[model samples]
Target chain A: MTTSKNTDMDPTAEPEEAAIAPETQPREVATIEQRAAAAGERGAAAVADAIEQGEDAEKAVGVLYLGIDLGTSRTSVSASNGQRETIASYVGYPKDAVSQKLLKKRVLFGQEALDKRLALNFFRPLEHGVLKSSEEGTPEYEDNLRAAKDLISEVIRRAKPRKDELIYAVIGVPAQVSINNKQAVLDAARESVDSVMLCSEPFSVAYGLDMLDDVLVIDIGAGTTDLCRMHGTMPEDADQITITFAGDYIDNKLAEYIRETYPEAQFSIEMIRKIKERYASVADEVDKVVVDLPVNGKPTSFDLTDGLRAACQTIVGPMVDGLSTLVSTFDPEFQDRLKNRVLLAGGGSQIKGLDLAIEREMATRLGGGKVMRCEEPMYGGAGGALKVAHDMPAEFWEKLK
Target chain B: MTEMTTAKAPAASALSVAQMLHLMRMEVDNAKLHGYAICCLMIGLDEFQTQAEREARRWLMPAIFSELKAITFQQHIRGLGLTREHFILAVFPHIGVKQATELSEELLAKARELELPGITGGTPVTISVGVGHNSHPRSDELETLIEDAETGLNLARSGGGDRWMQWRTVEDELEDIRGELDEQIREMRELGPGEESDAVASWGHALVRKIVDAFAVVEPSASLNQVRSDVLAIVSSEVDRWRDLATIRQLSEREKTIDLLERRITKLTGSLDQTESELKRIASLKAIDTGISSIYSTVQGLLDGEDNTEAKREMLKDIFEANLALRQ
Candidate 1:
């Protein structure tokens, strides 16, 4: 199943060595012919299993598995067909006939929708890593529901599933998402795939890296930061923590700082979001973050280095607090182990020197701790979900279908 | 009856006079298509008092033809041939009435310079030329133009043998107005930028007044209200057509922007796909565990192994149970 042996590294090794060890591991020595032969055998075995379960031979020939991380700011997918894709969580419809004719499309997705938002009825369907509207049958709810369905279809289409293949997907959502929201997600995905499942975002990140035991996963997403503690079994609600101090929180903070310091500096939330993504850091020393903002219709440069650092630093305290809660609540014997094997992941974790900053915070608050950033923070959740999809038994998929 | 023999004219270059006339007809038609003027000149020798004098002049005809051909070539005119024993015809295309008149006079002067041998003494040959000019010839006007030149030739011969005359028609007077109008339009176009609007306005007012005056004169019975309405309708339609053209230009600009956006989107999408593939390749190179293989198989394989089997089984069971609850 391609389990990650990163957690099996020496406990006494330097944190840097431990972090770099996983990437420098020697590749498996299987030849192309050997891998192909093994894959063929697996395919045959799956076919036999499917046939034994009373499925048609044609349906058993191919199955396309997908793992999806449905985040508030972005949606990502990892497909068994060696396809990976991510897009901004935006969808739009042309506002009028003129716009429709000019755009030559009835609907637009992601950045295209965002770019031509003035001519479109734009919707960002998810907030706090869940469907924005929970009240069923409302216009807003229906609109968000439709947008989410279209987004799921788009992400699935990007996977390029063949016509002959049966599609099974596992989606990773926020750890503490309500039942109704999970159902909403399931409802959206059902229209696009034959079978689907939902799992916690932090759990998926941990499982993707094979850190299922005595590891703490902090998935810092745009809408919410999910911290889930794994102890060799499925994490219940008690094992998870969700916080609002994530990417969007940083953007709002930075915007507030800019408004207070440079009152005349004109900027939109979208611009602030882009600026935060580009220059976000919690470190003391960072390059001067000079950004151009229009004042009286003219571009003016404003140095936002301190304001940005302050904004980015805001998420760290809440994140470590969540970590501290998970660590304190764990068994006494494994409390230090959980703190040492912390896995920092998701889009918000891409902030420069974030792991070290979190480690520093942990040292001050919890004596000493290690924070390891996942190599592909943006894709970690999706990759883990895909692994879950692949590992799911055929009967479970069939029953879901 | 004596049989008439077809004589090849020196200007016709071995072609019979009939063939030369056919070629002239074709050239006239071509000139009409291009809105060019065609001028026909008919030159005849002065009347001979005696048969012996006429015979002597007849022998000098080829030399006279050669001199006229040289003059035509020098003036860049072509399509010259002999139509009768006493007459030489020359066709010039793209020449205006004034230029053709000058050329006819030149031909007459050049012909008078020739001295031929006579019974009494060396007498200078005298000739008269008739010019027919059509500034905008129609395809069927070739025969009429030739007849007009013939009439002028007869008139010249009747008046004086050594003079030249032009056959003018009502069209020639209209040609003056056409030339003036074209010049005014060109001048208006060439006016300085700031002066253009005023010039165009004045020109438009004059044109509208001219049209109203023409309607009043041409249709005395028509009501003034009807005429005013007709003029208004014409102006409105022209304005509407210009407005439509402007709208089309705006639409075209918008379409270009749309096309640019579509191209940018396609390029970005391609680059994104490439980056994803590259990341995957890098992951594979680093032997990063993607966990793509099925865990069901992994669990079954681990059943015989002794490496954390109980914990692995319990973890798998937990994942299954959670997924089951979600699906249900």
Candidate 2:
């Protein structure tokens, strides 16, 4: 039984002794046992009081479940309290007191940070859907870890959980995040939540939509595209594939094409990314995508329709190749079922006519197949995580906490 | 005399004024929800109040309506007949004030070229046009748009007709008030101490009256509310600046206590980090008394689920085992 009250630390205890006492000191062990017993008694008393008052025990212990999709580019959260929010995966600290006063903030997140980067010590803590560094104790790692913690805290704040409600969060990480990176994410989230858990991003999406059987979910994120095969049970390592051919890849390719096609047109990766988000399509015919770029410091319109489409098309082949591997390796009888029920999701999945494009590619290579886009691609992972948090047994959450 | 009706019009028929207003309301609601621009134009004949035969007026109305529709059809504008000589045109989803004004001018020019049989030879039928637009429509702004178009129409009619006018917005009125206030404040500062107080008092009264007059034109909105709060905040801040020395000294002492408490909390938090394991144990125990409980208490509770109950239970079990292993 978890109590709402936090255990206090003895201020006079030496840090070195505190760190090493758990292993060597019987007295310390006895103290821990005594505290745990006291906590158990308190929990029992709370539940008994609630029962005596004829109130639901669970309602008396208010808990808000949160499902978070911590992506390389954006972090989204869906709360049991019916709040949903997403912020860009960027954290910025003002460079100095002057910058802080000018910005009127100690730290900024998301687009505001990007817009005011000149005065900010900016950090995008995640790369390739995992913490950028795995080595412990290095200054770079510590800074990034701090940024990740702050980013998580800001996102949870946006979820607007009631102060009286305990926060139980389930964060969706990339399918193949290393154990160390997973630990780092847990460490970051634990600071902001009472209980936290990690699940694979693609699995959460599939679970959220209840398409668990013979469904292949392709989550196209900013840093990686994760393909997971769901077969009515938990997915194993063999069931998930990740590729770097994703949103950032398309932005880079579009930037390359623009530089090649219009030598004088000046554009940044940010500008190219904005254009890709607005006009990314792999269809045969699309509306003309004319974007303005600086030419000799003058704004000039350049036609990027073909370049943008071509750049977007670059991902389809790799995606289908990954899909081919998943389908070919599956049991022969369910391979077709898997192929026909492909689900496209995530921010990159919002590309115009991507489902049809994926279907067309599948038809060419694997006879014929159908692909469906999630209704809310951006919220799918977080929403699924929320569902997982909700359905998780109370005991499991207690143990995790 | 014309009767107002609120029903769908035939392919060649225009909507009645009442019907148009209803449709405009719906369109304005959509625009507000979707964050788009919409414009309305009020068009009326300039100086054609001759007691023309009722037959002549009736004959002239549809022909003029069809011509106006033709001029606007390429732009997907909708028209409503207010009277035999007056009509309203609505352009929506993306049209703004400038575009609506241009459309009004185009309609006026096209109306001048019409050769009706009932009219005297070689004398063109000139029309007055008024345009109003909202780039970001809100629930309260629909009526403002209509009133603006009506006001512009009246202005055009009074200016000898055959012209288009756009009504000034409340924002424009607010800008004027701001300008006047700035000037008055500067003048008051230049006055002697005694005169300055009198001037400030008079200026404050005038400023409140001006704000009241400007805001009375439209219903209170978020932006207007923000302005009101800003004014209140400035006044409060000024009052605080002039507080007595004793009260200010007491507030300073309280602030110092607050700072000390904050620093103590920070120090306590630093020590709390040393007892991470102890805190974890407490947290795990705390979970025993769930603050907000999950919908289900145990795995068996999922048995009655309508779909995929078995699969969900297995998945839940798998997730729990994985998480348990990680926690360990």
Highest lDDT against the true fold, candidate: 1
Using Cα atoms, each model's DockQ against the true complex is: 0.03, 0.05
lDDT over C-alpha atoms for residue B106 of model 1: 74
lDDT of each: 0.73, 0.72
Candidate 1 lDDT by residue in tens digits, B137-242: 4323667677667666765676657887664542343355455545545554563433333444555566667777767666465487687778867965665565
* Model 1 chain A weakest lDDT span, ten residues long: A1-10
lDDT (C-alpha) at residue B162 in model 2: 89
Query: What are the clash counts of all predictions, listed in order?
Result: 0, 15
Error of 1 at A182 (Å): 0.3
Candidate 1, residue B160: how far the Cα is off, in Å:
70
Error of 1 at B73 (Å): 44
- Interface RMSD for each predicted structure: 29.3, 22.5
Q: How far is candidate 2 from the true structure (C-alpha RMSD, Å)?
A: 27.6
Question: TM-score of the candidate numbered 1?
Answer: 0.52
Candidate 2 lDDT: 0.72
> Candidate 1 on A200-300: residue-level lDDT in tens?
99988887787888999999999999999998888988999999999999999999999999999999999999998899988777889999999999999
